[model samples]
Target: MRADPKGVLTGDHYLDGDQACAEGALAAGCRFFAGYPITPSTEIAERFAERIPEAAGVFVQMEDELASMAAVLGAAWGGKKAMTVTSGPGFSLMMENIGLGVMMEVPCVVANVQRGGPSTGLPTLPGQADMMQARWGSHGDYEIIALSPNSPQECFDLVIEAFNLSEQYRVPVMFMMDECVGHLTEKVSIPRPESIEIVDRKWYRGRKENYLPYAVNGDLVPAMVKAGDGYRFHATGLTHDERGYPSTTWQTQEKCVHRLVNKIRQNAENIIKVEKDNVDDADVLVVSYGISSRVAVPAIQQARQQGIRVGHLRLITVWPFPEKMIRELAGRVKAFVMPEINYGQMVFEVERCAAGKAETYLVPHGGGWVHDPKNILQVIEAAAA
Candidate 1:
């Protein structure tokens, strides 16, 4: 099988989610990766390290997750599509740099192959507990795009989407993969480079002297410039003006932070995605993402056989929480049954969107493994009742 000039394999092959994710990044033109080895996510870094040389890309095993995240941001400014991968404790360690990435409007990707966690929980197992952390872990009021992939095939497909979204929005997109999907082997079809669409960062093209680092056009996202490219620009995590200088005042903060939040919030409809099945006439809707979505399939089928009108809503983009769809469905459905590996993270979002219009049931699992189909079925049965 012939790969493209950049060394992306262009054929169908069996792969695990981690390896597929690595290929997806390469196909999407990710030329730099900086990451620390962490459980369930190390394979992604390993695969990228092994294959990146063929693409003339760079891979660095950093001292820790914080340095890994920092290096990713630095690489992005150096005119490279960059990413980093980690899980649980490592994810927590990278929070500060993640906030810096947001404040500086850096375009990059962070993949968290989630394992069971409060601290150093289950290293080799699956968990969906990081859903909320993906949104709020950075310690500020900013917006982010997050994608969850349920299978190895999706792991290949969605990482490309994650990189595209990051470039388009100038935000670090979070790829939330649970350990179950990360380790699951399946057939992944890698399309040719010509067929796959890649979104490069909107680089500033006008006169170098006239460039303002944070100046935006019609879209709230500003155009970028490569570092040391004969362009003088300052980018800081502090509240700054369009020139990217520190101007610590409430006014500057409002203008700086507001656009950061609004850029994604206002365009959420264009950015958010979900998979809906049989929702038009269903009495109960099964809301899930990641491995839980795959596990919920059997329970959904069982409910259908038992004559319950149950539909499934699988979250493809978890953050910017698909509020409008949930609110619309809540008006019609009797209740929403959410089965996530976490105790009750995304279920809260469902409940908030439902807004007391319908009941919300949580089939909570404390991680380590996926939910039992029987447990999910019982919740669906009760929600239908």
Candidate 2:
């Protein structure tokens, strides 16, 4: 579907990541936004609140982050393509409902502009430390789609992809942008309304008398029906069956859980996205994502100048983690060096995927800022040695 011109901020302009994200959501047909302002990420909410009126959208400033997340899910099921924005503290508050959204198979976007933190860590600074939290903060077994944007341009482009992915899979998509990206200004060219491709809601079209809320139709995802849409269906936070009815029986649990996990697992290839450079003949691969991936470019160039066979793999989609690519590269490379602005989150995934076929190393940083190219180079040099 083409975007509606009313929401498309057409033409090129200098935009920070936060503003670009807001514009991207509007351009993608987001008709509702619920958010609580927080540093580094607050601009996203502010932009939406200011522009939504003109775009024929609803922007709500919820009392709290908890309410904000709950509202995002409600808005989604209410037939509005919805989203919410926040930083570390707010992102933490949204975890439980994030789990709820997963269980209910709600299609929404949660944009977390990360800051340094265990709690309210560095409100005004950058952090990639929340990468693990995005994966496991919401207790329970489920998979999510997460995207990392390294620039303001991507901040605009990836949100559209995020929303499209959410609707495509009937799941919540995470837009993970660190503080640096959110605050950094760069050029962003928004295409014309006719040029944008949008994925609309996968609405149920079955006869109302025989509707099954969670019934599978060839694909793992069941089509959805909006509230007050003259269709009878049920939605809940509890484990449910095809009819959206709760059943404590082991059989019901197995069916319910398997579908949630398998829907993503079965379609992993289509969801996984990565950018690679010089990996074919490289002896060491530098694996990074978000801002850290951009920071690694200089270190990679330095290594190449020093006659080292070092390659770069930037993860565009963080969740569903590029397991297959890592596994394949492990068999070819001498080692994989991962640099993330945290003690270590994704490095563990690389280690698991590498499975001892090759060595895996983590270049950890404790947030507030990005890693120095020297640090990454040191690790690459050691790995190359």
Candidate 3:
């Protein structure tokens, strides 16, 4: 249950992962949800469909993921906090429009509850297979926020953060959850409204006279105006100027694209987040995220009990990769090991951050089963030896 700032009862009820995701969005002031049905991820849409009417919001089941994602962008432009949830297959369909969201600077959330894939390998099974895709699925050079949750509670929390980042950066933030977290039943404590920090999209409040949609002012993010609020602005897939008008000039095109890119690229330091445990005097730093992080805790503890100086660093924000922290840890630790479902996704980021200062290794496994920490112990032994 959550209370308004006034401490009124919003509602208090126990919910599974899917239900909790919907409640999280509602609490975060998301008024629109558009998605297609896909297992594990489907319950999120179902919950939203049932709750939105009560929340005085809109819920739409689009014909496909592409349209569903498109509708989310449209809804956000119409001044609604919007989101869509889908699994691997539907997420593939949503990629083109995901690029559109990036190009348009629209604020929206796309939750990818990942199942095994390379074309529907497993519809109802777990996989951390979407980590790399989140960074590269959409075409073009652009930065995006992607958060991975290890547990149902973090799923709810990260969804809220996803909405905040989407609005703050004017980009589509992705909540990347594996089928394990999406289907797992767990007790998640919904905080009071006062406990939540909600960031609404920066809206144009000053005189709308001569408002440039892509204006490069002192603030990197410009205040956005609602589409139907009598603010006439043109949105395009083409290279455009600050006035949101198409530009034929090369210089103008470069300037527009550069600002859009730097607005996020430069803010990498402020956006990246990771959770560290007993790392100060550690010989090995275990790098993991999402559901794999759950396995890492015990691995670190068992290693510690054996007198190995091992620690864990769990990435909460998978994108905007935590380069600085990883770099700092590389100087301190003997080796950095990545345990993920994928063969080698974030392991690349770790190596980049390590820059040969520390040895990096991959303990990867996939196709429905999670990477066990016991395998990680062997890597620790090798590094220690």
Model 2 lDDT, full chain set:
0.93
| Pairs that clash in candidate 1 | none
Tens-digit lDDT string for candidate 2 (265-326): 88989998899899899999999999999999999999999999999999999998989989
Clash statistics: count for each candidate: 0, 0, 0
User: What's the candidate order when arranged by decreasing lDDT?
Assistant: 1, 2, 3
* Each model's Cα RMSD: 1.7, 0.8, 2.2
TM-score of each: 0.98, 0.99, 0.95
* Over 4 Å off, model 2: none
**Model 3, 181: alpha-carbon shift in Å?**
0.8
- TM-score for predicted model 3 compared with the true structure: 0.95
- lDDT winner: 1
Which prediction has more favorable lDDT, 1 or 3? 1
Per-residue lDDT of model 1, residues 1-385, tens digit only: 1224585788999999999999999998899999999999999999999999999999999999999999999999999999999999999999999999999999999999999989999999989999999999989789888999999999988999999999999999999999999999999998888788888779999999899999987799999999989999999999999999999999999999999999999999999989999888899999999999999999999999999999999999998899999999999999999998888999999999999999999999999988889999998988787
Q: What lDDT would each prediction earn against the true structure?
A: 0.93, 0.93, 0.84
Task: Report the C-alpha lDDT of model 3 over 1-385, residue by residue, as the tens digit.
Answer: 2223331114445666777788788878888999999987998899888878777889998899989999998999999999999999998999999998888899999999888878888898888888888987988777788999888777778788888889899999989988888887887787778778888789887667778888857757877999888887888877777778888688976776677778877898888888988888889988888888998777778888999998888899999888888888899899998888877888999999899999999888875877677898888878877
Worst 10 residues of 1 by lDDT: 1-10
Global local distance difference test of model 3: 0.84
> What would the C-alpha RMSD of candidate 2 be, to one decimal place?
0.8
Candidate 1's displacement at residue 349, Å, is 0.7
Error in Å for residue 1 of model 2: 1.6
